[model samples]
Target: MTDLLMNPTVARLTSRSLLGRKRTLLLSLLPLALLSLCTLARILGSLDDDIAGQLQGSLSADLLSTFGFAIMMPLLGLIAGTGSIGPEIDEGSIVYLLAKPLNRYTIVVTKLLVAIGVVTAFGALPVLAAGVILTGELGEIAVAFAIGAFAAGVGYAAVFLLLAVITRNAVVVGLIYALIWESLVGGLVPGAQTLSIQQWATAIIEKTLGYEAQLLFVESAVDFSTGLLALVGVTLVATAYAGRRLQTIRLHDES
Candidate 1:
């Protein structure tokens, strides 16, 4: 287990999968769009609080909630989470690792760490940079939103990793949850908003910025406590479940 945890080979594999051509391209898209929009917004006029408010409130909020959480987070999670283990499982290459003396749980934990790191870099960091670009450090709103993005990234990675362990269609299911449930239903249905990852994340931002801030840049359907609880609970449960699943996983024949 120690060797597996310390293994450079695992890190190499994780990095390769994460930085692969397709995943890298997809991951770059949203951040590029964000930067471009910020540049365009700046070019149009001087950065005013009113302009910042509209940018941060309407545009930034929409991008973070709709595109960041609903699209980018899940897509990045799907790539990082499933990319960490799915290909190995699909091609029966996992037997190489499983046959070693390492404990299965160690492998799972290592991969989960890699996935979390990847999600943080590709998902959360960009959100932070984008938030700053949109609103500056005004009232620390950018910092607040960044914290929410980081928290959401960790939770999203855990959930998607567990989904990878449970099903081959982890990406599809993740997309459905992120896009359909979080985006479509969570918007129109009042009850569904309480269950949304996007809302939970935004609630963190709302709390950090206060009620007046909530009235402006951030909006959340659920209260702060519920959102924090759900975020922490989902992250812990999904990680634990993924570890347990790894312990019992059976590798398929390559031939």
Candidate 2:
């Protein structure tokens, strides 16, 4: 089962390629920006204790939930996920890997795993750090949003990775989804929130913080049950479909 799910060689190669200097720099930019924002907010807040107190409450939560979860997480997921395999496919290097005696599903899973790790490290961890920087403590706001960031990271990675498998223009398509569907539409339209990964992850933060989430107005458009179900469902279904897509690509190449 483990062998079917992962290939060490594939994982190593995927990590090497994905974390090449250019990709690493791209991934680092967002997190650095996030932390810098948090630091600036904190510095400004320290000017007045009253301002600091107010900033620590709603402003901190907003930074963590709004910018961190809604914006940075999905964008990081898009970069890491698409970068994991899109370059190989685009450069026609995937054929070399596919020609080997390996399960296509295993290949997909291995790359997905690497993408998830990258998202977790670059996306989720930065949210956690930003939370601490903004809140100045490891409180409910920090912890809860950190967890939410992680959940969103997982969903985004899977969805974007699948997008890469299906389209050479995955980055452009993913930016539309991340910026349009998840950001603008999801934020403004109540009805569309049900279909949003950001809302689902916000639901998790709402659930984890419970009453505290309410105090900061950290609410999700969807309920916790719906959010959890959608998160798991999207990840599984997208990953399975990506494997199938890879198989089709292989058959076409053989022909």
Candidate 3:
């Protein structure tokens, strides 16, 4: 299994899919937009203490939660996760690999690793950079949010990878969950926050930054323990399930 996971062909395929022309362009856009926004804000000379506080307290927070985690991370994960398999499935090209003697689970794990890497690069790194730009590492907020983004990206990639295996509309489902469930319901309904990845991730950031900061960002329905457990559990389960699903996956006919 380890050998299969390390297969050069698998790595090659993963890299090609992740770095393909269209997807690469799409992935680059988010980080570029974030940096541009931060630069614009800086150039506008709106760095009054009050404004800086608001930028850190509200604007940066919203960007991390709404744009970074909710919009960008999930979208990137969907593209990476599903793109790892969806195109092969769609074009019936997966049969070439499946017919070989490689272990199915190995393939899944390799693809998951690639997806996780892609999400971290395109999603987490920008969040960290943006946080730094927003507050110059005040209270280690940048590091804290970056760590939260890392954890969230891992879970997001795993969940979306499973969704890709189980359904054709994985991207749509991921978008709905990221946008409607995490953003809308998680905000409007207090209880829904526990079930939200955004809240769980925010809880991590809160804990890392101390109680006051935690209280500021995380209105999670679940306690820290619950949120951590759910995040870890869901990621592991999704990866395992995706592996099992791949083992039995049937290739569709091109004809």
The lDDT leader among the candidates is 2
Which residue segments of model 2 deviate by more than 4 Å?
A: 250-255
Location of the lowest summed lDDT over 10 successive residues in candidate 2: 246-255
Which regions of candidate 1 fall more than 4 Å away from where they truly are?
A: 1-9, 47-53, 56-59, 253-255
- Tell me, what's the RMSD of every candidate? 3.0, 1.9, 2.4
lDDT of 3: 0.76
Best by TM-score: 2
Greater lDDT among 1 and 3 belongs to 3
* Per-residue alpha-carbon lDDT of candidate 3 for residues 1-255, written as tens digits (9 for 90 to 100): 468666668878988988899999988998788777765654443646666666666566666666776667667777788888877776678888888898877787788888888888887888888877876564466677788888888888888888878776788897888778876887678878778777788778777777557434644566668778889999889988988888887666333
Model 1 agreement with the true structure over 109-201: per-residue lDDT tens digits? 678788888888877888777677766554355577668877777777788888888777778888787678876887668999888777888
Q: State how far residue 108 of model 2 sits from its true place (Å).
A: 0.9
How close to the true structure is residue 232 of candidate 1, measured as C-alpha lDDT?
90
Query: Candidate 2, TM-score vs. the true structure?
Result: 0.96
What's the residue-level lDDT of 182 in candidate 2? 91
Candidate 3: where are CA atoms >4 Å away?
Answer: 1-6, 45-49, 56-58, 253-255
- Per-residue alpha-carbon lDDT of candidate 2 for residues 107-193, written as tens digits (9 for 90 to 100): 999999999999988988888888888888988888888899989999999999999989888999999999999989987798999
Which order, best to worst by lDDT?
2, 3, 1
